[model samples]
Each structure stands twice: as C-alpha cells, then as structure tokens.
Target: MLTEINFDGIVGPSHNYAGLSVGNLASTRNFGRTSRPRDAALQGLAKMRLCLDLGLAQGWFMPQDRPNQAWLGRMGTDMSLATAELRYAAMSASSMWAANAATVSPGADTADGLCHLTPANLVTMPHRSHEWTGTLAQLRLAFANSASFAVHEPVPAPFGDEGAANHMRLCSAHGQPGLEVFVYGLQGGSFPARQHRQASAAVARLHRLPAERTILTQQSEEAIAAGAFHNDVVAVANENVLFTHEQAFADREGLYAELREKLPQVVILEVPTSAVSLADAIASYLFNAQLVTRPGGGMALILPGEAKATPSVWNWLQTLLSGNGPIRELHVADLRESMANGGGPACLRLRVVADPATVDPRFLASADRITRVEEVVRKHWPEEIAPDDLARPGLWNAVASARMRLLDALGLAEL
Candidate 1:
C-alpha cells in the first residue's frame, strides 16, 4: 500500500525578510522587517507535530547552507557587486518550502514501476534559481534506493520549472493510478511566470505518464497579478476533490467540464467569485491549504492561522464543514512565520506516495527525531535576523554552524 509522506523542510537560522518573490504580497509587505529565525523554526516544527497527532506520515529535509559560496562563485560576483537583493538571494532560506523541491510521480503512475523525482529548475527568481542543485542533492540522499526510486536532473532551463507547486494528482486511493494535472502560467503580468508549458510537458513525458491520464492547463493571468505566484496559491486537490477559486484558471468552465468528463468521479469544490473574490482568496491564501484523507474515514482541510482571521474564508470553511461533503474536519495550523513570507502549511512539505519502510530511514520522522529537532531549534537558532545582517562579517559562519549542528544531531551530516 502507498502511504502519503509529508517531508517538511526545517527552517534555517539564515531565515530573514528579503521580499524576494515578486508576486507574493506578504513577502513584499514584510520586506526589511526583523525576522525571528528561532520562532520561525519552532512554528514549523509545531505544525509537523500537529500532523503527527493527526496520524499523518511525516518526514523532514535539512536546511541548505546560506551564503552559498559555490553559487556565488558561479555568479562571479564579489562584495562590490552584491546589492541587497543579490545578497538576500544568495542567503535566502526559501528552500524551507519543500513544495518546490521536485515533481514526484509515485510508482503507480510511472511506466518503470518506480517512484520518479525531477528537481525543479526554479529559474524565475534569482534567489530560488540557486536552490535546484542543493535540493536535488538532498532528494537523492533522502531517496537513495536506485532500484525503487529514480531521481532525475532538472528539466533544462529556459523552461522554468516550479515543481509540484504547479502540479496536482487525483486518485481514488494512494496506490491507484491517478490523473496528473499540470498548471502553467503563460504571462508573468507584474511577476514572473515560473512554470512553463514546455517544462510541464517535459516532466510528464519523463515520467512516461499515459496521455489519457494527464491534463495540462494555463493559470489565470489575473491570479498571477494578484499574487497567486504558484498554482497552489489558488488551488489544491486530494483524492477526487479539487478545492479552488473560480478565477484560478484562464478557462475555468472549460477546464471543469473537461475534468468532469475525464475523471467522472471528480468533485470540483469551486468557490464562486461573488462569495470570495479572487483578491480575497489570494490575501487569505484560501487555496494554499492541505487537503488530506483523515485516519477517521473522511477528508480534512489543514489551513494556516491567517485563514481564521479572514472573515470570508472562515465563514466559507464553516459552510463546507456543515455540509454533507467529503471534508469533515477543519484544522488550523499556526504557520504565521511561513505565511508572512507567502507560504502556508502546504508549502512547507513535499508529498511522496510510498511505503515508509521503502524510503531512506534517515529522512523519516519519529518522536525521538522531533524532540531532537526541537532541541536544536531552541538552543542554536537566532532570535532575530535583520535585512542588513546578511552583510555581517561572521553571519555566514554563524548560519553554517547552526545548520551543521542540526544535521549532526539528525544523523544527516553527509548532506
């Protein structure tokens, strides 16, 4: 049987406010503000623990070292040429959102009968563009069984790939073959369109997914302009249910018609424009939610704390919960640290479908591992980080030391 594993990235000590993502409203609004790395890490850990309590399979990815010297060398930039954005990009801890780590195809969906992973080439933003290499290395290390797993190089660039953030899968159960939906942005509008159609098609082909089981669609330009930087920002799916805003896609009606015709059992839980405007959805991150099958025999919605604060969102959620639908529970995870930077509960993890015993044991989480990770965050992580802190003479060393200490504690020092 296939189990859905959530591999969340540990927030690093180098976490700071850079406002690096263009279409992300929170990132822009919180730019240059003081950030509490310790608090951020703790918040993420708390969310993971909540998932554990819910009986969800959980794992973790280590943070990448900041002020990556090798990446700096690749850019050939010295201190003189380092602008604030450039410096922030070099030291960005955005890798903590592992949703952009890679596009995963479960063993059931691939032709080779092995799970496949393709690290995303996040070429849209300079800060994220440097993450693919390190992300790929970590992925390979965490999923090391060559006979059961195939971790591929990123699709060649010029075709920006944002990984699973723009992808969704729908199936009757974890072990069954599913319909893979690839969402791409045709226009950047005010921000860059990170995933290209060509890149999405390439990844689908690489997995050798049957054409009859795949769907490619364009994201709405209005959504991008309103800060829906990734498709997950406006849509989410679990099993046969797709929770999305009315304006999430360029051709919403047509897409729904096709989805219904193809999947037959597909349930499109679309939020009408009048009830919750597209702008309101983006502001509340209503679509950036984790839709999961509960152990109690029904579905649940895992939303960030911000959703509770938004009146429309909260009301709509209540309505959904009161109805005779698949979603029977509403969970609120306090992910303010991640939310302030344009991410939510769903952004913190990459979903992998496989047996826990089949994956690399080092990446799996247990009570002991969670306690150790909490200890590391509480003891070594910084209380606060400012925008200018990236330029401090010993900042790099400090961040690296913290990360190394955590890796050692987690027995993942090789990464």
Candidate 2:
C-alpha cells in the first residue's frame, strides 16, 4: 500500500560547530563550541525509533565520506594544505539535515505515474554546494527500480534550489493526488534567498506536475530577517493541515485561497505574532516541527525540546492542543545536538510518499538495522568535536573510516 516514509540522515562522525552556514543564527551563535558526534547520531537514532514506535515507515541515509578531498582538489587544494575555511567546508556534516536532499513528487501526483526526485544543488551555501552529487548517488541507489521511481539531476545553477525544505504538498491522504506548493524567496534581504523562483518552477516542470494543482509563493523577507532561512523553518504541512507562523509567506492569504480552492479540506492553523513572535518561532524552531499524520487518524507535531521550553511557543502550543485543531498530539524530542547546529526534527529527514515494499530494503529502517548502525556509531564516531578539530588529519581519518564502516555494514560499499 502507498504510504509516507521518512528517510532520516544519520548524523555524521565529523559533526562540529565550524560556523560554515552564513545565515543560520544557531550555527553562528554556537560557533567554536564543542560538539558530541556520538551523542548526536544516537539522538537521531532515537528520533527514528520514535517514528517507528508510532507505526510510521522509516528509512535512512548514511553520512557522506568527509574531509571531502575531492571537492577540495577541484578547488586546487587538499586537506593537508587547505586553509582553515576550506578545511571547515570539506569536513562539514551539514548533510545530517536531509530535508535539503531532494524535492519529491509522489507517483500519485506525477504525470508519468512514477515517483520523481530531484536533488538540490544547494549552490547558495559553500558548505552545502557540494552535497547534491553525494545526495543524488544515494537517492538513485535507494529508488533504483526504473518502473517505480525516477530520480532526476538538480536544476542547473545560477538559480538556487534548496529542495524539499522549500516544498510542501497537501492532499486528502498520503496515497492521493495532492496540491504541491513551492515556496521561493526574492533578493534584497539581509540573508541570501536560497530558493529561487525559477528553480522552483524548473523542478515543477521537471516533475511534470499539473499547472493548476501547483502553487508557487514567495517566502516573506520578514521571516528571513528573523533567521527563518528555509520555508520549513517557519511552516510545515502534512496532508491537508498547514501548521505555520502567520508571517511565513509574503502573501499567505492568497496562498491559502489557492490551497483552499484546490483542496477545500485544507486546515491552516496559523500562529499569530501576538501569541508567538517570528523571532521566538525561529529561535525555538517551533514550525520546524514535523506535522505528521498519526497512523490511526489524528495529526501529531514532532517538535524539538526547545519549543517546549520557550514560554511563548509553549503557550501557543497549549492553546492549539486545547482547541478543536487538526493537530491532536504533541511529541517532543531532545535534539540538543542538532538544535545547537540549527536543525530540528523536520530538518533531519526527507519525506516521500510511496509503497514501502517498492523502496530498496537495505535503505529501510528496522529496529535491528538501527541497532547495527548505532553499534557502529558507538564504536567509531568521535566523542567530541571542537572547532579546531576539523583541521586535524587524525579527525578526518576517523570521520572517513566511520562512514565507510557504515556503508560496508549496509552492503552499500559502492557508495
């Protein structure tokens, strides 16, 4: 049967606070702090376990080979002779945020009746620009069955694309045809707009989505200034329910009109600034929560622990729970390690609508598979990573070996 599957990226062994992200406030604020790689991976594993416990289908992506000597070689340097900036970029574990991995169109919504995926170029950030190649490789391997899935190359550069982080879909159910929404940003902001309008349009065209069912809206500069770097940082959607901050879109009312007209069952639960300011929302990553449909019937918000502690956010959440809203349950995760680097529950996974049996079994998550991955992490992932550690060859070797061991364990040694 067709269903929603969440493929979370296992936190990498080199996860550290080198402050490579330009507009990410948390990364900047936590710059130079020590990071616990083992704990971070285990925390992600626990979150995956939570999804499994909730009777959701789970899958995973292994960390990419790090101290990416290949990317550095193209830049005319290797790890040994690279500058601090280059080294930091090469060793970054930002891939742990799989939300940027790809934009997906389910078989139900695509013109060809096959699921389609396009990896994001992520050209806006130096640290993330090199991720598409690695991401595409894994995507092709996991969804290799030609009759079931079609994975496409990224939209060419000069037009930035941040993938599924800036995309959303609304439908009566996971298996049905849906209204796809593409959120883009314009120039002239304190922060660079990562998702270009042209890029969003290109992906829609590439996926062959019907024009009438697609909505392309601009993300508000107001939200960007407040550190809402990705649309998912301010808004998230599951089936027909949109859980968002009021200031998330430049023309939220117009967007909602189109959404409602196309799918009238749509329920937009917008939080107002009076109750929770954009600053509070972004700082707490309240909207970054995964608003997912529970296995039986209701909807649940998988939020970071930071949201539960923030007074304003928590207050509004209580109000939401007490009301007759679509979101019926609240689940909080201790993602301190990821939160420090500016990723919440939503950032760690890429969601796809498909038959679980159609996907490669090796990529699917089970308790036994998770236990094996966790064992490898415990054995090899570093205990702590200081900012200065990114420059050390010893750390690079460990990071590379840990990923190789994971790939071997999963029988994906070719990757």
Candidate 3:
C-alpha cells in the first residue's frame, strides 16, 4: 500500500556546534558551545519513536563520512593542514538535517508514475554544499527499486537548492495527486537567500510535475530576515492542511488564491503576528513542526519542546487546538541539540510517499531496529564535542569510525 515514510538522518558522531550557517538564528546564538553527539543521536532516535507511535512509518540515513577527508583532498589540504574554517566545514554534521537531503515528488504527483527525488545542491553554505553527494548516495541506495522510484542528481550548482525544506505538497490524501508548492527567495538583504527561484523551477522540470498542479512561490524577504532560512521554518503542509505563519510568503493573499484555485480543499491555518510574532515563531521553530495525519483521524502538530516554552507561541497553539480546526492534536518533541543548531522536528526528516516494502529494509525504523541502532550509538558516538575538539585528529578518527561501526551494525558497511 502507498503511504508516507519519513526518512530521518541519524545524528552523526561528528555532531557539534560550530554554527556554520549564516542566517540561522539559533546556529549563531549557540556558537562556540559544547555539543553532545551521543545524546543528540539518542534524542533523534526518541523522536523517531514518537513518529512510529503515532502510526507513521519511519526510516533513517546513516551519517556521512565526516572530516570529509576526500573533500579536503580536493581542496588541496588534509585535515591536519587545512585552515580552521576548512576544518570546521569538513567535519560538520549538518547532514543530520535530512530534510535538505532531497526533494521528493511522489509517483502520485509525477508525470511518469514513478516517485522522483532530486538531492539538493546546498551550495550556499560551506558545511552543507558538500552534503549533496553524500546525500545522493544514500538516496540512490534506499530507493534502488528502479521500476517504482527515480532518484535524480541535484540541480547543478550556481543555482542553490535546499531540497524538501523549501517544498510542500497539499492534497486530499497521501496517495492522491497533489498540488506541489516550491517556495524560493529572491533577496533577503543582509541574509543571503539560499533557495534560488531557478533551482526550484529546475527541480519541478526534473520531477516532471504537471504545470497546473505546481505553484512556484517566492518567500517573503521579511521572513528570511527574521531567520526563516527555509520555507519549512515558517510553514509545513500535510495532505490538505497548510499550517503556516502569516508573513511566510511574499504575496500571501495571491499565493493563497493560487492554492485555492489549484486545490480548493487546502486549509491554510495562518497564525497572525498579533498572536505570535515572527521573532517568537522563529526562535521556538513553531512552524518547523511536522503537520502529519494521525492514524485514527484528524492531524497532529509535532513541535519542538521550545514551542511550549514560548508563551506567545504556546498560547496560540493552545487556542488553535481549542478551536474546531482540522489540527486537533499536539506532540512536543525534545530536540535541544538540533534546535540549538536551528533545526527542529521538520528539519530532521525527508517525507517520501511510498510503500515501506520498497525502501531498503536496513534503513526502515522499528522498535527492534531502534534498539540495535541505539546500541551502536551508545558504544561509539562521542560523549561530547567541544568546538576546539573539532581541530584534533583524535576526534576525526572517532567520528569516522563511529559511523562505520553504525554501518556495520546495520549491514551497510559498503557506505
């Protein structure tokens, strides 16, 4: 049966707070602090469990080979000789945000009747630019069922694409053909726009989505300036319900009109600035929550724990739940490590509509699988990584081997 599978990137052993992202408010705010990789990975695992308990299928991608030695070789220097900036970039665990791993167009929405996936060419950030190649490898391996899936290489760089983070689909159900929205940015003044309009348009072409069902919209510069680096930071859609902030798009009313024209059933739950300011929403990652359909009925908002702490955001959410809206449930996930680096519940997974059987079994999530992965994590992941520790060769070796051990445990040693 066709269903939605959320592929989460297992937090890597190299996970640290180097704060390499420029426009990410949390990344900069928590810069130069210590990071707990083991705890982070465990926290991610717990979040995945929450997903499973909610009757959603879950899958995972192993961490990329960090202190990306091969990348450094191309840069004409090994880890020992590279500059501090280069070293930090090479070892970054930013790939843990699998939402940027790729943009997936389900077979239901594609022209060829095969799910199409395009890994994002994250060229805008040094820590993330090198991620596409690694992410591509994982995507290919997981979706190797050629008859049912087509995984495309990222849009060639110079036109930056940040994958599913800037994409959303609205339909009556997961198996139905849907209206796909590609949100991009033209300018953000001081903060550079990461998702280029051309890149998003290119992805639509690559996926072969129908022109009538696709809406390429521009993100509001004001939202980007307020630290909404990716569209998912301000909005998320599951089926027909679009839970978003008021100032999320450049032409909010126009975009809504287009959406209604394309998919009249689209329920846009827009939170007003009066109730929750952009600052509060960005800080708590309110819209970064996964707006997923629950098993019994209705929908649930899986928000970060920080959202509950932000009074304005929490109050608004409470009011939302109290109303007769389609969103009737709420689940708070503790993701302090990820939140500190500016990723929330939505940032950690790539939503793909497909049968669980099509995915590589080793990557599928279950209670038993989580246990096995947890053992490897407990045994190998670093207890903590100080910013200065990233410069040490010992840390590099540990990070590399830890990932390999995870691969071995999962019978994916070839990766």
lDDT values, one for every candidate: 0.88, 0.93, 0.94
lDDT (10s digit) by residue, model 2, range 1-415: 8999999999999999988777789999999999999999999999999999888999998898898899999999999999898889899899999999999999999999999999999999998999989999999999998898999999999899998999999999999999999999975267889999999999999999999989999999998877888999999999989888999999999998988899999989899999999999999999899888888989999999999999999998899899898889999999999999999999999999999888989999999999999999999999999887887889998899999999999999999
Per residue, candidate 1 scores C-alpha lDDT tens digits across 1-415 of 5789989989989998999988889999999899999999999988888888889999988899787777877778843467766788888999999999999989898888899899999998889999998999988988888877889999998999999999999888877888899999977576778899999999999988889889999999988988899999999998889999988999988888888887899899999888888888887888888888877678888889888899988999899888998889988988888898999988999999988887888889887788898998898898898877888857778888999999999788887
- Better structure of 2 and 3 per lDDT: 3
Residue 23, model 2, lDDT: 77
| Candidate 1 lDDT for residue 159 | 95
TM-scores for every predicted model: 0.98, 0.99, 0.99
TM-score of 3: 0.99
Query: Residues 71-148, candidate 3, lDDT per residue (tens digit)?
Result: 999989999999999999999999999999999999999999999999999999988999888988988899999988
1 or 3, which is superior by TM-score?
A: 3
**Counted clashes in each candidate structure:** 0, 0, 0
Off by over 4 Å in 1: 78-81
